[model samples]
Target: MSIKKLLFMVVAFTLASAAAQAAPLRVGVEGAYPPFSWKEPDGTLKGFDIDVAYEVCKRLQRECVLVEQEWDGMIPALLSRKFDTIIASMSITEERKKKIDFTEKYYDTPPGIVAKKNAGFSQSNMAGKRLGVQRATTHQCTAEKMFPGAELVLYASQEEVFQDLASGRLDAQISDSLQASEGFLKQDMGKGFAFLGDMISDPGCQGVGAGFAVRKKDTLLRDAMSAIIKGMRDDGTYKILNDKYFEIDVYGK
Candidate 1:
């Protein structure tokens, strides 16, 4: 009956109402992209993208729902509404822009090549050699255009590409530099292999690094998440996540 008690009850009710109305943000992730996202032996998803997704949803005050999707199907699954947004490390390429909108870049590592130590491969001398790349990715585009002399082999996942490279089925492989270092090169199977040459420079195909993809009409969601990404960088939250997965800042200059 007191005014103080009435005001406290009103605020509590409002808070509870807002909590009840908060919808879950479904995030699409490739559970096979190492360091970015991958599955554990028990099938639990963990990686940089997984961590970022949870953090973004936490800041947005929404329940986080992760949708596991294959790399090749990421955009199609997004367009079909299988998930509300893609937290997958998908590049912001011009070709993909036609199908979906992207948040501002979350990270901008360059693509690089992995080849056996002492291999006499060069950017212009890979004729008849098999080069592996993830299908439908910026790496594939760069390899196709830049290394026309090499035979391009496509795989559904980067893991497979690394496997073929390790087994000598592939002469070399192209992928995000950080992922190649952390996911493959540092492992035992990657022994005697080293990153060859400079990072692949193809701005037209790689676009402006990686971003969250949402349905083309979901500009509001895109902007909201983009703002959260910037806040994380400003507050050092992004660095914590970046350091957990990489030795250097993958967000680029």
Candidate 2:
């Protein structure tokens, strides 16, 4: 009836509408591996994983909050409720399934090893060489298992592993093949480095590749995310994001 009353009602309605549309969700991503997941200097998390998490939230019509977390403790953090879900490129392993559930893999890629182009590192004579690997990764387990006799050097992040390799502190490094190629080997710091051999695809050791790890109790959310991932793939959103960071289909079989 009154102008003042109408204004108050409009403001209240606007606030309610905004609140209804903004159901916040916190997502954890490993902010180290570039082209996949990494944190900017200003502490913003960005990359394929972040984009996918945001896209999932968009599909769910919710507000997604990105949380930058170190890779090793991402599962523990998830169990502790540090975030609602993990979009880090964590593998969908049975070992992990015991602790957390995962949607079907969002993408599948093999691991690769890198060394100085002239290093002549090979699977045969790697017996005593120092190898760098990120801690708590399938790469660490697979490298240790497959390349026995080489001394394993573990780091918290792939960035650190590459740093050690570039500085000659490590004879070689192993990580996600795409990350090894683009995140390090193709960069200036990786100028002298090159992949040692074929991409390693030990499904048992590497799990079934990368997927979203969710709390075991969150079945509804997990199903929602799985459907979203498939929708993104079928609708070409996955291709657009994949091509933005990689030349190949990271979602491929």
Candidate 3:
């Protein structure tokens, strides 16, 4: 072989070896969004997002590690390279797309309002209520726009909002329908709370649905994840996870 070609081959081999030794894909999740990703009492993390991410990594032939992060800082952490990807039930919105890339949507649920059963409020009655939502979430933005007169209380997490709602600090709370249905409705703490019909609109906030997030420059990783997510949807693993958490199919045909 020519000397130039031999040198090229040696450099290529070294690069390939370095790539092979790259660390496992580290996925960041809030680890507090029940039915999506959350920590168990035993310290292990599990849920829909956890299951879906595991499937995606398996399809990509890559090991997966889950990193617990607060909801407010999840995106910034992703940009700072604290994790390789985010699977924290993040929605694909134009606002977010400007900062980071997203895989195709894997699950979806409309935004809904949860209020005390005796509150006697509907979508139209939201004018004076104190609505609680997680800070830096689409729900918070939607509540602000949809109910201009309502007091929007931004909490750090869904758990915090729910806690305040149960303790009578909040008149109502807005969140994804599936999350309200599973995490709140099914729990004892949500005994007297009810969804005031579906307040679906604003595809950017309540309609489009959820997907994983990655840095815009990680095109290879994003493409691989998108393909894996598509396969999971087609092969029914996605449905199984949905069924485990929700009574109805949130990801429709």
Candidate 4:
């Protein structure tokens, strides 16, 4: 080929690749919950949920972009096409299913309660204590339903709930066990806190673990994401990522 022709072909291929990369699919994340999704000191989002979403995109042969959205508004944003999907450790529940479809669950964790260590309260003593949980989350629903008379204080994010609990504004807090273990119980701020043994058992409150949320009409996107999750499960990549952050195999034996 002539030098001029070869140069032109190279330029054309470069432009095509740039366009493809620019057309990445945007995925929403809360960017405030550690061990699941959180923003680093440098303002970049990083966590298990973010990693899992990237892996799924890799399998689908699509470029992935992370969009930070408030946890409370994630669903509404997705429905409005603010993003193509949500991988913010959102639990797949029937209520959510009514508004949006989900890929197969990618992770599962139980619910647990955190209370002041010397508050003289155990799992059995949670009758009237004020409990804090993130608004619109399964944890909040579980706390309200399972502990009917207990006071429930809803916050906008897990960090806010924990902050209140740490400041003694809340008697206790309920959240995902993995997050409790890794992000709270294992942290410096958790030194004086303890996890009560009681577990919230409502599948609806706990949901069917966590999954990717896509608009109900996006069957192509949903199926493609589901296939990626299933393949990861079969090949052990999913478990590896889970264990890296959770220190436990969340996928079960």
RMSD of each: 7.2, 6.2, 4.6, 6.4
lDDT of 2 by residue, 1-253 (tens): 9999999999999898756757578898888889788878998888999889889989988989888788888989999999989998898887889999998889988898898887876866789999999999988889878988999999999899999899989998889988888899889999978888778777777898788989999998899899999999899999999988988889867
What range of 10 consecutive residues in model 4 has the weakest lDDT sum? 244-253
The residue-by-residue lDDT of candidate 1 on 160-219, one tens digit each, is 999999999999999999999999999998999998888888998899999999999989
**Global lDDT of each model?**
0.92, 0.88, 0.84, 0.85
Q: Predict model 1's lDDT versus the native.
A: 0.92
* Best model per TM-score: 1
| Candidate 4 root-mean-square deviation in Å | 6.4
Best by lDDT: 1
> In model 3, which range of ten residues has the least summed lDDT?
198-207
Report backbone clashes per prediction: 0, 0, 0, 0
Give each model a TM-score. 0.91, 0.90, 0.90, 0.88
Q: Between candidates 3 and 4, name the one with more favorable TM-score.
A: 3
Local accuracy of candidate 3 as per-residue lDDT tens digits, 1-253: 9999999999999888658834578899888888777788999988888888788777777788888889889899999999989988898898898899998888777788888876877888788789899999988778888899998898899999989999999999999878877888889999988987765678755536888899999998899888887887778887787788667776754
Runs of candidate 1 exceeding 4 Å displacement: 1-21
Q: In candidate 2, how many Å is residue 197 off?
A: 1.5
For residue 50, model 2's alpha carbon misses the true position, in angstroms, by 1.0
